[model samples]
Target chain A: AAGMAAPRRLKPLHHVAVSGGTHGNEMSGVYLVKHWLRDRSFAATPFLSNLRAVEKCVRYVGRDLNRTFTAEFLSSAETEDEPYEVGRAREINQTYGPKGSAQAFDFMFDLHNTTANMGTCLIMDSEESLLPMHMCHYIQTHYTQSSCPIYLYKLPGEESYSIDSVAKTGLALELGPQPQGVLKANLFAEMRALMACALDFIELFNTGTVFPAFKTEAYKITGRVDYPRYPDGEISAMVHPKLQDKDFFPLNPEDPIFQPFSGEEILYEGDSTIYPAFINEAAYYEKKVAFVKMEKRTFSIPGLHTLSLSPSP
Target chain B: MTSCFVIHEAPVRRVAIFGGTHGNELSGVFLVKHWQENGAEIQRTGLEVRPFITNPRAVKKCTRYIDCDLNRVFDTANLGRQTTEDIPYEVRRAQEINHVFGPKDSDDAYDLIFDLHNTTSNMGGTLILENSRNNFTIQMFHYIKNALAPECCPVFLIEHPNLKYATTRSIAKHPVGVEVGPQPQGVVRADILDKMRKIIKHGLDFVHIFNEGKEFPPCTIEVYKIIEKVDYPRNKNGEITAVIHPCLQDQDWQPLNNGDPIFLTMDGETITYEGDSTVYPTFVNEAAYYEKKQAFVKTVKVKLTAKCIRSLLP
Candidate 1:
């Protein structure tokens, strides 16, 4: 029922939604949004009012809320027996869908956290958007105070079935891993800043001043694994599991998971070191491995909203 | 044996091209080499060509610049005067390259010049023409797009006033720096090289000269957005401690604003903003200037204009 409302009219123009904590365990945005919801003193300011005046605002909880925006999934909600997050995604889409069409919302962001040690990343939908470099610059300047090493991720050719692949303009902010104690509050503030920047871009878009462009060259990756590999034989468990730029294991060369069997020497390949190695012992089979980094190129795409990969040059 | 060739068989017209300023960026290096090896087979009908392989040392080192980004050292007043003997080996090498390519006493050595480079980010696909909205820059963009068939997107032409300070561009009356992306064994380098070669061949066929009246392409200028600045923050033990979030993508991020909580030192005390009333934030790995991981960032936005776009013609 929340999906049927007309789009909210705003003075500036365009609309955007920046949602975090889609993975549940990456609780940075969860707590920040929680704080905003519970604390009146924080939300009563004029800045907070301006943020609320925007077209749409989203605060999500749980994993995979980012994976439910396809037309097929949107059509069969009740009959498909979907989970609450999926249904919530459908509701958001319906309300944000184009004025006459079922597609709702012009821009969307799914915020997340990565391993504590990984670099900050701006993961964008490569197909629909183009200017990742510009976006990276904006993110670095506006969100992280030019202090965090930001990277641009272009989805590999192999793993195009994920949720990020569908949206016209969507970015996943990986605030490095779950924080502990004091670090937790810091992470929340980072998420809050990221959200505020997204809101600013939305406001800029509505003002007709937001011109989006993209670089054609993206970090071309070749492999990704949804499952984790257990140590077999003499090979000790990987003290640090990471993705390789080239080569694959467990069959298909395109297969995501690659592990060195016991007693085998580890070989280092590619220009950079291994990345996105999962540390959580309880990670689901669908959450363990990610795409391996490979060659990338810069290109340009012309459109109303452009996706740019803003990795450090 | 590696030989440098000059093609002046055609009636002399002022056009100079310098490639391989940065040894690591090979698109321009190979493109120039290809033309030299096959000049007779690829020379245009009536244009004079001067090609120089500047910064041979840095090229050997495979660096972005010889000493201090040779591209950044161009000054008309400093012409012919060596800056320093104690500078890095690369910087010294850049001075030599500058002397060889720069105009001696007059500003009429060449009508147009091009300095080529490869960038690490994916932002190098487009041609970067220096600080003017001239016809030469405009036509060069058209020629490049038509000849090279670079990635199938619209070419982005950026103009920075500070670019006038660039050594290669500043030395000549008209100079353009063509960035081809990183050379670190990636597809971007390969594609850009292919495109560069195509443009070189097309230039030979068109017979366009820098000072000659060859029509240039139309280009729009865009500005660069400096998104984030990285600082490495360190703890007392020298281990990386906290990542400060000073800038936010969302507009609601403010200092001590509701959800805003400052990170604490390892001993569990919050680090507050000591400066101005504005929100100060820092990312995770900035350099540790303070004892605690309490660095902050200030975000600013600016727009790029379109009139500065130029072409690498003549």
Candidate 2:
């Protein structure tokens, strides 16, 4: 396994971690931190990042907080320019970061829920991150009823812009196929279990149990696909009914991807099979992404490779 | 000009046209902004038009609102509050708006209020959501219905149930909310905007004719009154386990009988509407209310005896 060159035992990573609704409308993460805030054993700092947007029941107050956590944005962000999220990112980085600084927290688990029925997923920024792979494997295998699929979403050397990117060690826990602003209790319990499992994996690593080595498969995001647009830039088609909420499902070469205003099926022209996620995401409608395409790959635990996401999704 | 039953005495009618109540819906915001800049654009013989945008900051941000929904903040208990740091953005805006156009119970309030709104639901053309059965509101509905061609601007009136004037339009003598839809928030469709502008003009003309003591021929107006809100079929944990069924999608204004498939679960299980009687559903799968878990609202058709100037005057 890659990155297995470390001594048999590494120090137990009990440094600080934080997670909750980075995007205000995602209620599962918003409430998960809320539950943690009440528990006494919780040492990690919890936050409801976009409190204003939560109250209003919208996605964000200023802009999407998830996309505003780059080092560049943290350094240059004023209380203006994507006003609410940018300022908050600066504050989060100061408290938990000066991002990628090893002197800070060991990891920050960012929780999120999607409008697409993506179910439970562990989103890793880089492919080379070994610890996350083993951890995700443990969760997926242990929880027979619920599979924890890994999705590597990093683009070729692009700096991470998500909330968890500020941490030296972390991953984004996305739970969904749920609607925005609505709290589903079952998903709530599942998210809590996943968080607990993440903590347990860290504890096992710290205490020096020789983890069983295994090759893992992950779907790496290749790029996004947008709805076809007319000359005036208005979308000319919508996601076909066949593909509405089928996140992580395969797109066969001739699969119908979109249904145009004329009601004709627009078939996918790609030659090979690919997985699509975030299908018909309500929030992405404004950003013009119909869905993100992912290519399946096999990587040994702790391997990072350069992958390019398509230009637009 | 259409002939009318003219009466002797004249009455001055003050009408308020409110837009951007939910600021992200651009059609209303744009129309009100247009009128705000060019006040002389819309005119009628005996009517006074007051055009206003309800939530300007939200409009500026191209958001639904800076704080809470302005539409839900106009309840009597929430209105007229002194501005404070703790006060929500919408509550303060609602209070400020109340001073200018409302305190619906007061004599100083506008004679009629038309609050413009948009929805992402498949409801298209002109959808009028009015709560009260006041004769004036019904007459205006009928006038607009007759004004538009059948295929062009088909008007659908939904009688919303009001709880002490919670909505911005509810705080008036004759409040009518014009909801045109299938348009996403922040999108400006020319055809939808033009339909709204035409309805605003019709509202002015209808009220003008009323103020002139002219009577429309007494008529029975059909309207749908909301009775209940139906949510998505949810699991024990409140997560919706199913989606709106294919057969029920975009079936607004059609009679839905009991046992009709309403939702289809992930497991391929179909759930049907359990109500005893057939009811009409509006706002089917409205994107905005997904957070509230309300997939649609069920309503029943009722007829109103609508008379124009005579009913209001007498």
Q: In terms of TM-score, which candidate is strongest?
A: 2
Q: Compare the candidates by lDDT and give the number of the best one.
A: 2
Residue B27 of model 2 has an lDDT of: 74
Each model's lDDT: 0.43, 0.73
Q: Give per-residue CA lDDT, model 1, range B1-314, as digits (tens).
A: 21322212222355566776766565666555545545554455455666667766765443445445566555544444456767665456545655565553354445556676654333334455554354445455555556655443123333444313445555665566665542231111234565555555555444444224332223343323222333324546554343343333121212334344344433234544343334323222211122223343332222232222222333
Q: What is the DockQ of each candidate?
A: 0.02, 0.05
lDDT, candidate 1, at A100: 25
Off by over 4 Å in 2: A1-9, A51-58, A77-82, A302-313, B1-62, B65-314
iRMSD, per candidate, in listed order: 14.0, 9.0
For residues A150-190, what per-residue lDDT tens digits would candidate 2 score against the true structure?
Answer: 89888887788888777776788888766565555557668
Model 1 reaches what TM-score against the true structure? 0.37
